[model samples]
Target chain A: MRGGTAVSIAYQTLRLSDLPGLRAAIRSGDYVKHTAGLGAGHLQTNLAILPEAYALDFMRYCQRNPKPCPLVGVSDTGDPMMRTLGRDIDIRTDVPAYNIYLDGKLADSVTDITDIWRDDMVAFALGCSFTFERALEEAGVPQWHIDHDTTVPMFRSNIETVPAGPFGGKMVVSMRMIAPERIDEVREISRRFPLAHGAPVHIGDPEGLGIADLSRPDWGDPAEIEPGKTPVFWACGVTPQVAIERAGVPLCITHKPGHMLVTDISETAEVPVLNPKHH
Target chain B: MRGGTAVSIAYQTLRLSDLPGLRAAIRSGDYVKHTAGLGAGHLQTNLAILPEAYALDFMRYCQRNPKPCPLVGVSDTGDPMMRTLGRDIDIRTDVPAYNIYLDGKLADSVTDITDIWRDDMVAFALGCSFTFERALEEAGVPQWHIDHDTTVPMFRSNIETVPAGPFGGKMVVSMRMIAPERIDEVREISRRFPLAHGAPVHIGDPEGLGIADLSRPDWGDPAEIEPGKTPVFWACGVTPQVAIERAGVPLCITHKPGHMLVTDISETAEVPVLNPKHH
Candidate 1:
């Protein structure tokens, strides 16, 4: 992990919060990189665009699985403007990368999706760990993957998500290594952002989560546990993708893993993860 | 406010925690009264059953207007059972009475909806003031109308709810006369049940809420202020009814104004009213 990469990502995050300016870069194809460490104080979301036919069921699925799918904003059918998420935000161009799906299979990875935007499409934005990951960085906790310019270590967990309509799958989790002394501080900061997956689902012992090895991850890089540090896991946004693929809708699109939409909503915004029955 | 009504209502509430016994009484033709004080500690929800076509937009409407529409449970399309709300809960016969709407007009009022149930209908449960009003009672605060056996005074306010598709209308508020000394305690208690309209939207003024006189309310009975009491208002669940009526779908069904469904969920349950942007 390099010290300079963290500083560079930090600079982009701080500067881009002048959101319009940052979005211009992404919109104009001047900045095409993954939005891993960008967009600091504002909420960053995992995007999913589904047909109107599948929208209602998917919403129920999200409500049932708030830990992995903390919904931040939903767009009206056929509407490209995510007005609730940000001022003058166009869902088709705001996100840097998109995974286009045809009949539930990934067909293409593109920078801009305006060409394929349809009249019956509905876009939904779910909260990503990017918000809380920045919180950890601000609170003096180290992020191994961000510094290394690598993806966070994510794993497929044994826990099953509550099924809705045609969506159901096992949960996916992201792991971070935290020193024992800083564990309390990390938990305190993270739990406050319920939209950002809240507290750790598992603090230590990967085997308990049914992961056979820390070295082998289902997705992303393997984050090694430093001496005296425990492995902490948070529900990952990828869990929804798994359900979507299994549901196999004819046309579905999502942010290519690691790329996210930077929402105008701030981290301090007080939306709690809703009770399942209350959702 | 009377002495014996409060005592009798309290007695039914306590005896009903034996839920099966309570529901059996409601399920059969035996108990057909309003559910106001009957389910003290459990979650009591305002019910709305909509055709599948209108379900998505109505959901967005609820998500957009959390103070007035704190969504508690959503039934799967065409499903009569609200699996998430309570065990063995059948929507058709559970609520004491239902308002049947055809083309936005009240067509009929009935105790059970099974005879009219269809394959493309969805039922949604929104948190009602019944839960928080019970809290006010438990906290030693006085509810003028409840104690007097009258409907809580509700008024239409000038605040416009964020509109979704065909659902957009002004918010409705419920007013209560609170002794100035207990105002803080009432606010503190109500805010904790975000699912229960959170805190008061206005305190100590009727004119400011655009009411010409507190003596006349738009819905429910008028609550008069006692010598040292102040008028406190919370956003009412009826706000959604206004939107639903304006949308005027071909078929819409809701619980009768004062009648509600007593859910298996408890009042102490921790569902927060979501941030509008984050919903």
Candidate 2:
């Protein structure tokens, strides 16, 4: 939004107060659309709901691979309320869109998942990259997705995540082109959001992560690499979803890509530990 | 151990490999005493086993006050195997000694807790101070405890820990007297072991943490401060036990102080961030 680029899509204008009402609108079977620019300045989350049996392993998986699965909040067993992430956030009815996966296959896409909600289900809210992406823009980094009116390019990488039970798969990463001189600035800014995918994993070549070409990504649109810029890769939140799919669980529910669950917590709750004191 | 003065205890007489054999001896009801200096270069942990209902609150407490209660490993409900801490750790009988607490009272002391283990209980292993103490000795910061054949002096400080649920109390700290010149070296060495109370919370004076007299410690034997030495305090692991005692839980079990669970993980495993490049 800071860059002087021509606007293509009708950008949804929203205020800080619009969040709870927008969530309410989504809860009552209204406003079932992509939540890209809606509810500005509030933290949005990637959702993963599974049975209590898989909860421990999934939690360990997230702990082992924090960059891709930075956990924001965990729900108590058989409870839908996520107290840490938001106030009165019902996981069953909060998100604008939900995707149901059955035995590693997409079963259906729906607006509300309350009818199929079970007692043993537990929801995990993971921090998404959008929070840090906004931080990057504020710090004066040029993002191609904002300028081109397309989703950020994400690719399936060959970097395997640490295994915990059935949850083990190659990490997926999203790429953004940044000016070479701004590389340190970008790293310093993004590393603050450990809840989001903190810092760039790879700096230069896409082939380092086993990608054959930059034009063809596993998800999202192709990114334009500008002159005097380098491609910076960040561990994407999609990696956990991909791992969940690979686990072949009976039923797994997640938010539809780009249609995130808006939370009441601020994006800047805890100050970043740059050269972390470690205590 | 590498200092000028002669000591009652012979330093470096123990080897790292002796830990497993010692633990085996303890499991078979043989080495039923304090575990100090038994395992040379390995990590030892303080134990806290509680019911499933209280696990979440305690976890939040540890998350809030990581300096005092740095969680090394956590066990699943009804599971005794602490897979993350070591290769073969059965939480019920690993430690040489155990103290059973019932509703804020000391119910009994035992060698093994397997007979009293319940199906709904969880075990947590918190990092102990021994790791940093070893690092301090290696960095040439002499401690009075090893020289005098006694435990490090501990005190209940007025510094209150961040509260979570029912777990809220003033932090307890362990004091070690070091030469004023070596204080920076002590901080540099101890900061590496974040799990083990990482850097000194207060250095140079006991009165800063609200202790009126240095010679009168709340716990452990007080030692004489040599000329030009200052009293340094590190957040003690005993603070969590104090909180648990005050919480008045129906049943709780903890390691008798100095009788910790010796882990196979090396002292260097205390590093929080293992860069993927190194992995």
After superposition, the stretches of candidate 2 with alpha carbons farther than 4 Å from their true spots are A2-18, A28-30, A37-40, A271-279, B1-11, B15-72, B75-123, B126-279
Best-matching candidate per lDDT: 1
Task: List, residue by residue over A56-88, the lDDT tens digit for candidate 2.
Answer: 678767766778887766776678877656667
Chain A TM-score across all models, in listed order: 0.90, 0.91
The DockQ assigned to candidate 2 is 0.13
- For model 1, the stretches where C-alpha displacement exceeds 4 angstroms are A1-17, A134-150, A177-192, A199-205, A226-231, A271-279, B1-15, B133-150, B177-191, B199-208, B226-232, B270-279
Considering only chain B, report the TM-score of each candidate against the true chain B.
0.90, 0.91
Q: Candidate 2, residues B210-240: lDDT per residue as tens digits?
A: 8998888888888887778888889999999
Interface RMSD of 2: 6.6
**Two-chain DockQ for each candidate model:** 0.24, 0.13
Candidate 2 residue-wise lDDT at B132: 88
lDDT (10s digit) by residue, model 1, range A51-117: 9999999988877667788777888899999867777789999887899888779999998999999
Model 1 Cα shift for residue B126 (angstroms): 1.4
TM-score, each model? 0.85, 0.67
Report model 2's TM-score to 2 decimal places: 0.67
After TM-score superposition, the amount by which residue A231's alpha carbon in candidate 2 deviates from its true location, in angstroms, is 3.3
